[model samples]
Target: MVTDLQERSDQINSSDQNKIIIKEISIESEDQNQKKIKESKRLFNEGSALNNQNKYQEAIVCLDKAISINNQYDFAWNNKDNQLLNIIIQDMHYIIRINTKKQFYVMTKLYLLILNMIPIGLIRSNKGILQYN
Candidate 1:
C-alpha cells in the first residue's frame, strides 16, 4: 500500500512539472511574438520616414521588410500600395508629357473608326433621325 501511494505521489509531481514546462514554453512564445511585433513596427516607422522624404522606392523596400516580418501589418501594406500608386502616377504623367501628339493622333483614329462602324443610313437619316444598334 505504501509503494502504491508513493507511485501516485510521483505521478502527481511529474504532472505538475509538465504543467510548469508548458507554461514556460508559452511564455517564451509570447516573448518571441512581442519581439517580432517590435521589429515590424520599427521597420514601418523607418519606411514612413523615407516616404516623407520623397524616397518612394526605398520606403517601399522598408515597408516590404516590415510586411515580411508580419504579414498582417496593415499600415505597411497601405504605405507600400501608396508608394506604388505614386510611382504609377508619376510614370503616367511623364508618358503624357512625352507623347501628347501621339496620344491625340491615336484618339482621333479611334474616333474615326467608331464613326465608320455606324450605318450610313442612320448617319444620314431624314428628319435628323439617328438610331444605333
Candidate 2:
C-alpha cells in the first residue's frame, strides 16, 4: 500500500510540472500580444495627429500603412481621412440645410439619415469599408 501511494504521488507531481510549463508559455504569448496592442494604438494616435494637422493626404498614407500592420485597428476613423470626409459631408448637409435648426442634434440625426439612405448592398458590396476579411 505504501509503494502504491508513492507511485500516485510521483504521477501527480509530473502532471503538475507539465501544467506549469504550459502556463509559462501562455504567459509569454500574452505578453507578446500586449506589446502588439500597444504598438497598434501608438500608430493610431500618430495617425490621429497627422489628421489634425490637416495633412490628410499624408495622413491617409500613414493610416494605410498602419492598417496593413494591424488589420484589426479601428483608430483610423479618428484620423484626417474621417475628419476631412466628415467635413465634406457635413458641409453638404449644412448647404442643403438638412435639419439646420438643431445643428447639434440634427448633426447626428442627419448623419444617420444619410447613412441609412445609402444602399446597404452598395456599402457592403466592396463599395466601401464595411467588408473586412
Candidate 3:
C-alpha cells in the first residue's frame, strides 16, 4: 500500500510540473511579444522623424520594417501612405516647374490629378445626404 501511495504522489508531482512548464512558456511568449511591439514603435518613431526631415525613402524603409513587425499597426500604415503622397506631390511640382510651357499638357494633367485627390468634400445634396463629391 505504500507503493500505491508513492505512485499517486508521483502523478500529482508530474501534473504540477506540467503546469509550471506551461506557465513559463506563456511568460516567455508574452515577453517576446512585448519586445516585438516595442521594437515596432521605435522603428515607427524613427520613420516619422525621417519623414519630417524630408528623407522620405529612408523613412519609408523604416516604416516598412515597423509594419512587417506589426502588420496591424495603423499609425505606421498611415504614415507610410502619407510619406508616399508627399513624395508624389514633390515630384509633380518639380515636373511642372521644369517643363512649364514645353509640357503644358502634362502639367495640366498632373494638376487635374492633384485636384481630384482633394481629401475633403463640402457638397450638400438636395436631400441633405452630405454628398462627398
List runs of model 3 lying over 4 Å from the truth. Answer: 102-133
Question: What TM-score goes with each of the models?
Answer: 0.70, 0.50, 0.76
- Write candidate 1's Cα lDDT for 80-130 as tens digits: 767876665566556667899666665565457546644443331222233
For model 1 the local lDDT of residue 66 reads 90
Candidate 3's TM-score reads: 0.76
lDDT of 3 by residue, 1-133 (tens): 9999999999999999999999999999999999989999999999999998999999999999998888867788778877887888788778778877646776677678667656664343434334577
Comparing 2 and 3 on lDDT, the stronger one: 3
Residue-wise C-alpha lDDT for candidate 2, range 18-59, written one tens digit per residue: 999999999999998888777767777776787677666666
Model 1, C-alpha of 102: deviation from truth (Å): 5.5
Which whole-number lDDT from 0 to 100 does residue 99 have in model 1? Answer: 90
The alpha-carbon deviation from the true structure for residue 97 of candidate 2, after best TM-score superposition, in angstroms, is 27
Model 2: ten consecutive residues of lowest lDDT: 119-128
User: In what order do the candidates fall by TM-score, top score first?
Assistant: 3, 1, 2
